[model samples]
Target chain A: MGDSNVTRRSGKNQLLDLYLTFAKIGATTIGGGYAMLPVLQDEIVTKRGWATESEIMDYYAIGQCTPGIIAVNTSTFIGYRKAGILGGVLATLGFVTPSIIIITIIAFFLQNFAEYPVVQHAFNGIRACVCVLILDAVLKLGKKALTDYRCVLIFVAVLAAALFTPLSPVLFVILAGVAGVILMPRKKPEKTGDEKASDAGGKEGTS
Target chain B: MILLRLFWEFFKTGLFAVGGGLATLPFLYDMSARTGWFTTEEIADLLAVSESTPGAIGINMSTYAGVHTFGVIGGIIATLGLICPSIIVIIIISNVLKKFQDSKLVQKIFYGLRPASLGLIGAAGLGVAKIALLKTDVFQESGVLAQLFDWKCIILAVCIFFVYRKLKHSPIFYILAAAAVGIIFKL
Candidate 1:
């Protein structure tokens, strides 16, 4: 829908634009997810007019809900909307290019120096910060995820299972999806019984 | 063969790690536990590096793990493996379902997935806590209660946590500051 300007431009130029824009965003943003959002909005929405703000939010929503890294997912969605499959692939490649280059260099050096006393000491501190950052993420995510008691129940159950059992996290994700579909509609019926009931029943029948 | 395994593992990670970059931690921990490709401590190191660095945290971590395991080429393979799912899924959604985000079924599945992913992340946080806050090896060897905790790390973690909560600086700032503290105190 927003490809009018893109159509006027040559395919090669548009693709290069998509790749370079995302590569710049990827290189500049320090943290992923929300941190990347403002920069993404600036470059893709404000600067380039590739997508509207609302559309970017939609992309983010889907990006969060679906699998894979959110930044890459959003980049792909925007790129696809801008051009096509080639656009999507190029954008994703552009997004991760900086990461590959930077991390490969760091990993190359870190591996060699990893055993050194000073590097080890620095890593010890960094590890503590990792714990802190993860703790912050859990709190933020928990606020969003644990909305009701059902969600709280799932959270506790999954946490217990994760710690104690040998079950794969992949299994947990799938099971939780099933559980959500089964559990959520029951809550909806309290507000509008007939409509939701039939809707759920119809969906269940189709599947 | 190792590279293939790395690809497959990260592919699955990309496929199932719902929510965001941090969600990949549990899968990485599982990968280490199963394959011994790297240690939990290494994950912590990589996490720090990933957080401070540019680009997506998931891509950075995967690249780091791949490089740590197999070399630079391994990093490339693991990264490609991780993004393959996103490419396929996003393209399908873009071509097929314009209203996929508004679908009730999609919302329902995520309703369940969100908390479950949180639990997985919480468990991963505990894993990092173990590596960051405790000295299991010293405890195992000495069998002393006092030896169980690395008090300095515990103090460092507590201080960093509180300081972070109060200051609200970017994660990189705190991480870099903590590294300075570590070097100064030889933690």
Candidate 2:
């Protein structure tokens, strides 16, 4: 009984630590899920050692392929891995609570603020910058996505399809998956799923 | 009833919005056409707001959309609805997906998804570029070369794009700088 109680206390402490860490992350992650990459390396991998670097990349890919927000999904995956269902719940709540509170406050005043000139102008200037931010993100992701000559074909085809056609991006994503299964050269099977490829530059861990 | 519908709509969005945040743009457009809860122009604002804010852009926009149409309760319900799929899906995957995690097939699919996602982001970026730089309405209205684009916005966007290369700070920094410029220039 004493041992069980001790375990419970430590577990609670870990959960609390997890919550505080993610709360700060959710609050300050300016560029969204991808932005959380560097933070995760710092907090989760380097600081906490809760997950290995490759696992985070794998989880990121999983987060992307699965439904829901990638940030929420990845956080949940980490939370669940660390502390089971409740851990998952607390971590998510922690990650999103800032957004909820802030967005709620913004929503409360936004109706009134929407028509104000300074607010509108600020939004205008910010919108132009938002475009640049998106461009930056695309360029970064492009480096990862456009890794090879054969991949170039898939990249161009997908880009043109997304740009001009009526085809849904979702459909393109699915089709690309199929193409990947078929077209991407089948690398020799690594003996273990979790085996860290030593040559990997850890680019996935970087922002 | 509207809350329920908002929940259902966002639930569908969360279920299918593969890729990332901007991947939900098409779904948001669909919601606009089908429900008329928010207009296209309002969605543009939501996009900007979502991009600028902390947290996941997809959830922030959905929460904002719900609040815009339905209020605080709507925001809660919409957020819960959107994340439910993720929680459930991750729970299942975490438990059962270990064996299949390393298959060549899975790797290939992700191999495709990474660039496809980039391509999709590029397309979305172009859409934002149109909204930010081009005054398409003016082009349609006046058919004048000078009136085709907002020169100030274009210049500002170019400046931001280049400046971003040098000052790779947090997004909030650039956003605030632009806001300051906006207030100073009344952009």
Candidate 3:
């Protein structure tokens, strides 16, 4: 109980650190979630050692299927790993602080900025690079996620739906989860007959 | 009363708009129908603003929409609503289902999810590409190949693609460079 209390006390400081770090990321990143990935890799993997690059990709995948902004969800997950529930709240709040302020300010004062030609031209250019950045994410994720034909098939089918049909991504994700359950097979324990070996393997064996 | 309605509306939006920011568009459309808070055209405008802003489009849109209907406080409440589900869901997964991470069932779910995730990302990318590369509506209206492309953005995209292949920079650098190109071309 004393140890748990000590951990919680120090966790408050780390929670603040998480808030500031995510605040910077939230303020700086543009063009949305995929654009945030490279920044996240820099902050989470290289800077903080909070997660691995592959781990970031994994969080992103889970974040996508989960509700809410993938970027904020990812921030919450990272913060939770570091400091528990309060950390998650701080991280999410930090990540969104700049956005809420910016949008609210814009909503009240600068709603007409979109009509400006300079802004229009700027957005037109920005949109293309956003696409490029997103493609970069696809490439990086492809290296990690696309290990087999089954993976490829799922990707292709989902891509077609995204481009052609206005399908809810939630529906597609649910369907994918179901597909996963049906298509993926269990890796049978090899030492099923030997109880002692099975015991050892059950404790530690992994792919 | 307005705040409660705003919170409930965005709460539902955040709970179900899976995939990411753009995924919320359909839900927002449904919202327009039910509450008459904003029109489809306004939502489109909000999307542009959300996309260009330095955060998740999902949060930005909800905040903007909230502000439109109520005020700054409404913006806060609505954003809270949208993000509440993510916090709840993620906290549950982290605290309880952490064990399931290693299980076969979880592994299988991920296997299926990875590909679908890719598809969603790819489609989002394709949507951006279409907006940047093609003049689909113009082509639809004119039915002519000659009037069917935004050649300037296309050339710029191709060049940027190659440069991005050889080098990497912060996202801001590319956004600024693209903005410069836009200004130069008076796009």
Candidate 4:
């Protein structure tokens, strides 16, 4: 009983720490979820050693499958790992609370605010910046994902389908999964010790 | 009855929209077509507003659509419904993650998922391009030069691209800078 109690107490403390950590991530990261990657990697992997880089990448992949923001998914995964269900909730809340609060405040003033020249100009500029950020993310992810011909083929085919056809994004994702399943080399190439370490290291940088 | 239905539809949208907020666009397009909740033009406007705002694009659009459909309560309901799935999933996943942490199957599944995720992001880029680059009747019918293209957005895109390459600065800086240029040029 005493052991369980201590574990529970420690879990709660860990949850609190995760919440604070996510709050800091939320407050500092300028471009939201994708931009949060480097900072999250630093805090969760290098600084704290909460999860290895590969684990963080796994969380990111799973986050893509689930709803809400990627940042929220990541925070939930990390917090859950550290604590439990309550930790997941607290971490997600901490991550999203900043945007929610900021948006709510903006909502009050934005209707009329857009009419203002400065606000209009600012938004116009912001849109361009967002495009740049997204492009940067694409480039970064592409570098890691497109290491081989099969991956490149998937990227190009999917991009073409998305750009030309009126196919649903969900359908496209499903198709890619199907293709990956079919095309992935039969022998899962054994990773050398160095390769494994590098993979982990690459993940660590992004975690 | 209609309001409740609207809430449920948006709720489902929130539930299924994987990847990110942009993933909601295809669903929203279907919603507009099926229910006549809004028009394609309205969707464009919604996209513009959502892009400008400070929240997840999915949440922002949900709130906007809900408010348009009913009122503030509708907006709240839609937003709640969209986020509800994430809350539930996170709770469940958090509990079980450790047991599955090192599983090869999990790794394989994610390996497959990476390409799909990239595809989704790419699709989002295309969607944005369609809106930003392709000039429709609005620009075309106006005049010969207008029909050629909206050079302003194009120029802005190129200029920003170069600036991004040169400065390697955070997006906020570029956003602010582009907005300054837009206002100066009246674009």
Best by TM-score: 3
> TM-scores for all candidates?
0.62, 0.71, 0.82, 0.69
Off by over 4 Å in 1: A1-95, A106-111, A185-207, B1-82, B93-98
Fraction of true A-B contacts recovered by candidate 1: 0.76
Worst 10 residues of 4 chain B by lDDT: B125-134
Q: Model 2, A26-109: lDDT tens per residue?
A: 875554576666456557865677776545655765676788788889889999999999888888878887887777778888
lDDT against the true structure, each candidate: 0.78, 0.75, 0.79, 0.65
User: Can you write out model 4's per-residue Cα lDDT over B25-143, one digit (the tens) per residue?
Assistant: 88889999999878888777776666665545666677777666666666666666666677778667755655774565544454555665665555555455445544666666776
* Tens digits of per-residue lDDT for model 3, A80-109: 887888888999999999999999999999
How well is each residue in B1-187 modelled by candidate 3, as lDDT tens digits? 9899899999998888787888789999999999999999999899888877788889899999999999899899999999999998888877655877657676667678877877777777777788877899999999999778888888888888888767866555776798899888976
What does DockQ give for each predicted structure?
0.42, 0.46, 0.55, 0.32
lDDT per residue for candidate 2 within B49-162, as digits (tens), equals: 676667788878888988888988888888887887888899899987666666777766766666666665566667667776788998998989889888888889889888
Q: Which scores greater on lDDT, model 2 or model 4?
A: 2
Worst 10 residues of 1 chain B by lDDT: B167-176
Q: Number of the top candidate by DockQ? A: 3
TM-score of chain B of 4: 0.65
lDDT of model 1, residue B96: 60
Ranking by TM-score: 3, 2, 4, 1
Please give the ranking of all candidate structures by lDDT, highest first, separated by commas.
3, 1, 2, 4
Query: Which parts of model 2 are misplaced by more than 4 Å?
Result: A1-66, A69-71, A74-88, A187-207, B1-74, B94-96
Q: For candidate 1, write residues B6-55 as lDDT tens digits.
A: 99999999999987788899999999999999999999988878866778
